[model samples]
Target: MSWHSDDGSGTTADRTVEVWPDDDRLAEELGDALRDAELAERVAAAGRAALAAHRREAAERDDLALELFLLTLVHDSELAGGPVGVRDRSGSTSRTLVFEGDGVGVEVELQDGQVEGQLVPAQAGRVTVRRPDGDVAVVDTDEVGWFHLDARPHGPVRLVCESTRGTCVTEWLSW
Candidate 1:
């Protein structure tokens, strides 16, 4: 009369995560009335708010140290023959990019076709490089407002510096 056969070989069950009780904190907190879409929307909104707040706080700093840190990381690529001279085949060639503006001084070395440098500014947020190819690369300064640029050709190039207050661009440099 039972659902199982009297032979004692019915169906055995074991504790498995997929088939067992799972964490229901989110469900419990949101309640059964809230749909999945609503929960997702709420999470997205919260994330946006947090991102906005962080950006605002960064903008309110005395200087762009945080932005400079990011810039350093991106521009710290290794370039050969330094960033100033033509690419050489021997691999002993290297150059340096010197950025001087608004009482800030920064020196970066170019080797292995990469840029590795730093920022020595009282305050800096962003740094941008416009290569002769018309491609643009922008990097944020770190906590110390330091930055570097990747190794590129000696053609017409532009360097732009930016912060919460404003932006400044270098005229042009010959390779």
Candidate 2:
């Protein structure tokens, strides 16, 4: 049988089962399982909160040492045939950005909705690409410090390279 609460809460079942006629072992087990589930939920919530806080703190600190400096736009296929100061985006051309920091040089190429890049001074390490919407792609560099990503992101994006020398983060760029 089921009964509905007058306060519009919900319906409750008043059926009785004899699964544990000897004692309340079934109820105890259920209680333990529920407690474990609740604890897990709380831990997950705490972790989410901590991550949000960290993102906020990172957003506020713009002068981090690991933050890489924007050197210059070394090359742009769009401007290959045009004047140096001319701006054009009507053609299907890739863009290349060069960033230098901590004696390391990174070349990023944005082409056909894919990101491919290389690092100078050949070193083995990991490269993390982060988008403005918090989406991330992590890839390990080869022994020659080269990495590629099949996935592309919209809006502004940044890169953080971790190598034996140190960690360097690139400034956000939109292409």
Best by TM-score: 2
Tens digit of lDDT per residue, candidate 2, span 18-68?
566545787887778767977879978999999999998887675463454
Score every model by TM-score.
Answer: 0.39, 0.52
Give the least accurate 10-residue stretch of model 1, judged by summed lDDT: 68-77
lDDT for each of the candidates? 0.59, 0.73
lDDT for position 149 in model 2: 89
Measure candidate 2: CA RMSD: 11.5
Runs in model 1 deviating more than 4 A are: 1-91, 122-124, 132-135, 148-151
